[model samples]
Target chain A: MISPELQAHLQSVIPSSSRAALRTSVLPALLTGVARVASTLRAAQHVSLAGTANAFGDDQLNVDVAAEKDIRAALAACGTVVTASSEEDPVEKPVVHQDGITKGESQETYTLAFDPLDGSSIIAPNWSVGAIFGVWDGESALHQDPKTRQVVSILGVFGPRTTAIVAVRTDDAPPACFEVGFGDQGKQTWELMRAHVQLSRPPFKARYFAPANLRSAGEDARYMALVTHYISERYNLRYSGGLVPDVAHALTKGHGVYVNPVTAGSRAKLRKLYELFPVALVVECAGGRAVDPATGEDLLARPLEEWDERAGLVCGTAEEVDLVKEKLLG
Target chain B: MISPELQAHLQSVIPSSSRAALRTSVLPALLTGVARVASTLRAAQHVSLAGTANAFGDDQLNVDVAAEKDIRAALAACGTVVTASSEEDPVEKPVVHQDGITKGESQETYTLAFDPLDGSSIIAPNWSVGAIFGVWDGESALHQDPKTRQVVSILGVFGPRTTAIVAVRTDDAPPACFEVGFGDQGKQTWELMRAHVQLSRPPFKARYFAPANLRSAGEDARYMALVTHYISERYNLRYSGGLVPDVAHALTKGHGVYVNPVTAGSRAKLRKLYELFPVALVVECAGGRAVDPATGEDLLARPLEEWDERAGLVCGTAEEVDLVKEKLLG
Candidate 1:
């Protein structure tokens, strides 16, 4: 059953000034792309062979590469998107129009930045993985700045129930949060499960994530001790080697912490534009906080000099994230 | 697509001597029940309310209790199952037939022991949880001896795809393994994906699971040290708070190890008949080993005297499990 409020969410992502015009635009195409990609990923169990190393130097499962192609095809066929940027592609790829408009000539309304298939390395284990995309309103033919320009951010988790969590920030309104159950195969059909949901405050249990082993080589002892401290405090370890599902888990539960810390001699693990920024916006929109451990500022406020620039992520319930900033990083 | 071999596996679980009779009888009903139950669980993301505590004293998600009812209703409709047993129920519940078979009058062919919603705790977090069942060929009514009297064991993982991993031992031949994509929702629609798959040997990278916090109080220092040693050795950690998916990962990857060890106060974490025996049968069928870490005996060989009898599980690649026995327990 697609929730009625989910359509409201899809509609809200567009600026109210252009609501009617954009209503039949990029959102429908984006949702279609996500659903198709999810449907394609369902075949991962049948395809077990690890294909090759991805652009990020992680082992790309055959399913991952296929999912990227499926999403790209779905998005391009939408005709509203001008260009697609992904961690899988070294350079931004132009989406061909069904009409005879060339890439350089056709006026497009939106540019998409996405991680077509997140956490490809863990596909073999059958762990939950997801696809994430952010949409920027096309003022220019291409959005020169991605981090500050995105009008909508989405995290899609293709787990037991395929879900799309959307954060829509129109210039007039504070960002709104909604979760839509996609993959049920209804065009423009979405049921909104929650509205104006925010992370729960203190006295809730905390769950956290650290992608790489803190005790692994070159990781600082102090960082390891901090994680050990979190463990000692009875924080549940919630890392699934997938950012989309982990963040979605936090969003739904309304509590728990998730972190990808920068270690000594290494930059932060997740890409700023493709992953961290979009998720940070969602977290912030939900009244939760995403912060950089180094400067102790909101991750959303940080400048992204490069699309691949990375940042340490500490995000979750307002209190838990506050606790992390105050007690550990302080 | 449901693998063709998977259908053969469902049929093969019935003893060849009575193959035709049994195939037309209870097994199809049972598979239908499992598939329906899995399909029901696919909606868990929408049904996020926490339910009453389960028999294990763990917090039960609403889906957990509902899943038990869904499976029970499906099985009862089949007319072949006499009684359904699960961790959720305080005692074995007799299946109520649509034709109104009284508890005493109806002669049932199979007694099922199951964890209807294994890893129920992980459901809220949207992590992979599973449905596990062991079928006992009924000579009498409800089978009192659970450990030894099982003819078939099936593990269903509800991840991106709803997969049923089956191991059928018909006395004369070695147990056979097959994976069926049951959620595709069509009868006799499964296509064969794999046959006689085996666990990879020592040179294969290892993934391990120990559900408890290694740094927690009452956990033995020796065990902690051993797990830390394994981590240093670069073994991937694969615990998702779900046994079926974790073990399924080992079977599919053809390598890795999973253990629910006996902590200081705890006897062992996993229940004998419900989880350990069914999984052990599947692992051993795949040429891996599932052992009682104490006496160095196979878990399937041990008698389960009580419904909640706990046993330490150490199962994976033969060489890797052997390493656990030699280096840690021994």
Candidate 2:
């Protein structure tokens, strides 16, 4: 549960721009809804109970449906949202506004696409996993199918005109802060944080925790244990077992690192990373950092017109993030 | 293919001592037989294709059979054999002179127990793997089975007086020399090796390759690639993909490092590191080193009686091994 002080801080940090309003007001609720749907999907598959479960197969479809519904509902709640389309249903058609919600006339517009889960296949072997996304404005859907989505356009969003954001969760402590970055500026932010923080110190051990599944409580527990053990042995770092949860936790914690390094073959496995940004500007104002590792630039700095081609991200205190960038991109 | 010069060098370098004769006359045949049996088992599984076979499973059984047959045959050929017992069929009672194949008057006696395929399960994942063995001068196998077999008084060989040798094979280069260590003078040998090698170079890269199966030729290729990449990138080092192959290669090459870090669970995983003396000896002999990271002591110097309870090993050119030992054990 989020402390009242932290919740207020989150609410106060939201930007006043049109993008920020939608992100601050509607993104969290949408993510919560998506999490619920994902949970339902896992329950249906009996993955949350005792028995061997194939983590892939139909569970993927369930995540897709849940992601679509959450994004649509969130968009509908924001009057400025003009016809939202996602990679899941890429017809450029307006989202079905359920609950009789109507969109208000506003120049502000955006499109979102995502992989609700990444590295899901590794769940059986208990490897790291997470979610990913790509977002843009003036476009309803980026690709015809989620399977065909490209990260190149996502990279485009890092250009001077665009804004991008990502939220992560794991099974550590909760009410975490989300990281935000824009263009090359993100790299500077990361470096600053690194210089200020002694990365090798205790409670700041370098650990990675990517949960493959988010819905099943049982799997969640296992994911938590894995993360806890890894962190406890090293630096006492914690995660929330979900992309948003983990990202949020990182933002609030002020130390540690979060990454979503998806190789080419694993793009479609997760989507939360892709969706949270367009609607969650609160992460930015909370003194956190996030950016795509490939460009060593901010995730939110690029315009929505070009956000499909970008690689995955690293989000944390500036210094730790810079270390990753140096290792991967530098 | 081994160059003629290298082959000649190997043949000449092998000691002419009774034990050296045993290794020269027995180890190669055992390795060859194990290879053949492994191939046959792979064929049985219909996994003989170039790229699709698993290398660790039932192939282990075949390797064991082949190794046992070759070792026994070699001992018998030397005319210093009375009876033999193997770890696999310990209850069969020592095979007495029969069918005129063996001279009943020959009082020479030796016993051998082997894990023909160590880390065999790593074959499926295309990782490094190998074989190990212990030789004793008695009639029975080292560890007895729970179920009583047809023969009872087969002369059990107990305690640390027995000599042990391990043969490792990896996919890097040809098999080199064996690591030889004696129970009484373990630490002395370790220190000599530590004084000779250079270990500190930055940008060090470490990789673990444990294949799940070993019978598939295709799996061998993958294992080879991993070994080559890791060694080349880290230290321009090369090792055989199997235990004997690796130990032999390291012994002669006189560079690089070999380590088996403790995994999350399962103490049984450390057996291969515990059993080999010559591998450590050769590593030290060639200006390299070997130590158990958990204990910070030279593995060869440690008493074998206490090895079953130890964790894992870290070995390399003396300097590198020492660095790891200092970080982990210190």
Candidate 3:
């Protein structure tokens, strides 16, 4: 788990430019901090494992529990959260102690529905996987039905002001830091990366890393190494293997590009994130970018949810993300 | 160019199995023979120190001219051809001699269209590529406009049949062979090749030589080396970049798999080949199998042209091709 001080530091870094000032608010920034910390912890655990089986159902539950606890604590500290509803808690199957010492009942204003480990199937094969969440204001209806409750939160969160972020944090830090540019600047960056390698002729080759089990530190390190190799501007090669942890490694390391191309089959999840300013704010704070490739517009500025929605995405950098969108939409 | 004797040797060595006899005929076999020779000659010319470029607009044109010349010469000698249409003269373009000599003109009865190079772009990127063709009976209604005339011969001979071939020639010759397994077998072959340094790994990967270019002794040698590295049972790798040249390479070497994933887009080409017996017959005679992955059915029964048709294909050894179909279709 990330220390509270570090979480506070992360919150402070939310970009203040633009209407993002809303995202920089104490509430959203705190949520972003909590989410980042959860991801970091999950990544550490995944790297310690050897194979993908280590990341199945129960394993996923454990990671989600840890993340939920951290997030809840963070929000509680701020006192902005009047009540919280989590997918992790069972509505009917309440916890009971043999000693008749029951734990506190569920209490929260906002509800959260999350898939803590999406694309987990790719773990054994070294593919990308990620965490996804939807948040809605506490007063939304459907808070009565357990099954329908998760859907309601997701639908409620689908609108402009919603944010999505994918981070690629790596263990290896380069000697010098660089920023990725958009549009023409982005193309120039690619050319520059290629040129630098061609001139130096470093014995570099593109590599892929996908950590399946974030509970294992060993697997996490391996995944981190792979991201480092891919994002090194000198090498100019990056890989996501289809998961958030793998992508996050690349973003945090500030090396290569990280992209998630929206597919026609998976737009529901993207729409759900547009209702809140948390995820997008955190990603931008980390010096990355997120958007829906189909529109080439700020994803947060669009409707949060639509039945005909196509796809949603987030990337480590704006340029890299845009390139992926161009390929898919073109 | 392969001598007439060598061509005869190749034709005689082809199997006469029931499956082989049912799928192809004399005309297509002769065309295949001509194609082999033309490809060899082109490869040889390219490799020679006195490199020369033919006036043809593309590799496809070059192959057409070479194949037509060989086929005409052979047919004239054997008195087997009553009439034929070369792709270069689809409308039987009048051959006019400008010299001060007596003028003569002849009309062609049979129409042919040939794509001597398919997936040619693969070569530049060091990927696989091949050739294609379609042949039909010339008895169809003729159009006054040359461009409007239906080239039945070319249209009839396109698709998967152009890709299959028998592994063995005659008792005295070696057999053509290819594998059926999926990525596992491919990876194993890749590993073996890399371990022996017989084939270089990617980043500075091996070059892709067009079959036409591979015909030259030097280019042929390099191509053979690559083929040997791939087809060795211990390696268990089959290479089928596309039709025509790829199949020809397998036919020449006596072994290699031909893979055509049943994608949603390739139905039209498959249907056209069903009209002509040449492409299908040649592959069967050469000792290979042709199969549709969707139904695990023999693909040589007929051609499929509908845009919505869906099926994958693998043409080579019966056992190997079947295995591939199972893996992909499943």
Candidate 4:
């Protein structure tokens, strides 16, 4: 009747032995962390700034710091996370618990990398912003290439209505997507929005998003030309200056493309591990494609060799991503 | 202490005799209609459309037809409206009430014009869409020149959080804006987010929205050139293909511009009565400016002489509007 809940779906995909482990331990902690962060962001009008710049040279709004702390505290309470890192932190740190700090001792130990509050810049203007997280089971090497310890789970939380897009993969299966929202009873409930939602790119309208401030002088002129061409072809422009919602729109609508490409005019903006890996995995699992411009290969083909290196990403239906390769990157 | 409620603000600006009339009659009915429509639209996922086409030749989703019915039904119960019209309906029609079908006889009778679901096309994709309404007290003639019966009250309802923006004016005073949302006990309550908010143009980072798909061979080349110039100036594009939320973002952010212009390539797209008049009035009241291209004057300088005439609008800080006039329209 309710279809399989996200937790139930996670259980169904895993070996029976580890099903309870995920259902009772790791997923609950991750969900709790997201909910707490969502509650904090709901009252964003009152959030203050810490007056410090984040690792990315973006000012760390006070809300970002608070959300990170809240997520960390929530995860620590669940006692399943061995390590955690965020865009605000310089390096991965052990999750300290009441019993003791986790040193990656247990086989069930999990690691989390997150952007506690993505798109913080647009919060004051009542724009939709989100929190994104990626989780790995068993801490192999906290900062290794994403391929080395590929994330088993990914989460995107859009603040309004506390809506969540959660996807989980097990063993060697494609990721299964589920949605969570507050029910009429004011309780958090999950529903399966898509089992394997795929993209169909034919008859593409050229809807896309590029960062507003592209370098005035650079190889980006080709990218600009592609945008102009798309406009001339009558593609509707639907960018919101937010990654989570923009990507979600593409998925929900089942078409269109989103790119963060490297050019002479602008360095690739999305980072491989913190941002693109989880997003790319979700898009690919949903029957879409995610490509890296540098190698002209699938973005998920390998673990990111450089943690801080800029990564170009093109994602959508196979046709759309292919067109980006041919028209924009070729 | 809480700032004055929208109703109280409305009372302060009007004569004592008419203040109660507006407070007890017209405003409540308008607010109720908006709330009913907003509640209906919040779950746009479930709305069943009649599968008809609206007057604009755009396909009408079932939600549009349903919202129009809901709003009309709510208004019919209030017994204060003399005439009403909606975008889904082909023409302005008299409101037949429970007491009896009375023409525009009493001075207290008001006329309502609304777009029951603006930007309904984007609803399926989870984009923010809104309901807009404008009220004119004492309907001299329905669907006449927009200049003849200027709207005294305008409402924009963003369905996500049941947020309503109400602007009211009386006795030739500048309009006051207030925000309404559901409070404890699920009762609608009002808060003043901006008391006489004004736009200050400086250090402009271009954040703007102009609908894509401009007629390819139309006289709009100069407008396109101005957009290119803005991009060169590093203005950020933030269009959601929805007008109410797009314009609301510009107001709430206190910066940015929103334009719906007519060029040789295309006629004015927004309707003078249902869309532009209310939006232009709100933008102007909020310390911003709204201009009509054909007349090269303030949008509200006079009533639109034709109900069905296409109208071009440019709204933002005075400086930005002036720049638009000088650069594109010049």
Tell me the spans in candidate 2 whose CA falls farther than 4 Å from its real position: A1-330, B1-7, B15-24, B44-100, B103-110, B126-128, B134-254, B258-269, B272-274, B302-311
lDDT by residue (A263-292, candidate 3, tens digit) is 333222332332222244334435545565
**TM-score per candidate, chains pooled:** 0.85, 0.35, 0.28, 0.83
After TM-score superposition, what is the CA distance of residue B176 in candidate 4 from its true location, in Å? 3.5
Task: Give the CAPRI class of candidate 1.
Answer: acceptable
lDDT of 4 at A30: 68
Model 3 interface Cα RMSD in Å: 25.3
Evaluated on chain B only, what is the TM-score of candidate 1?
A: 0.85
Candidate 3, B143-246: lDDT as tens digits: 22221232212111111111222222223324322111011111211010000101112222212211111112122233334323332222222222334434
The Cα error of candidate 2 at residue B295, in Å, is 3.9
Q: Give the TM-score of candidate 4.
A: 0.83
Which model scores highest in lDDT? 1
Q: After superposition, how far is residue B277 of candidate 4 from its true place, in Å?
A: 1.3
- The C-alpha interface RMSD of every prediction is 3.0, 27.1, 25.3, 4.2
lDDT of 2 at B222: 34
Model 4 DockQ reads 0.28
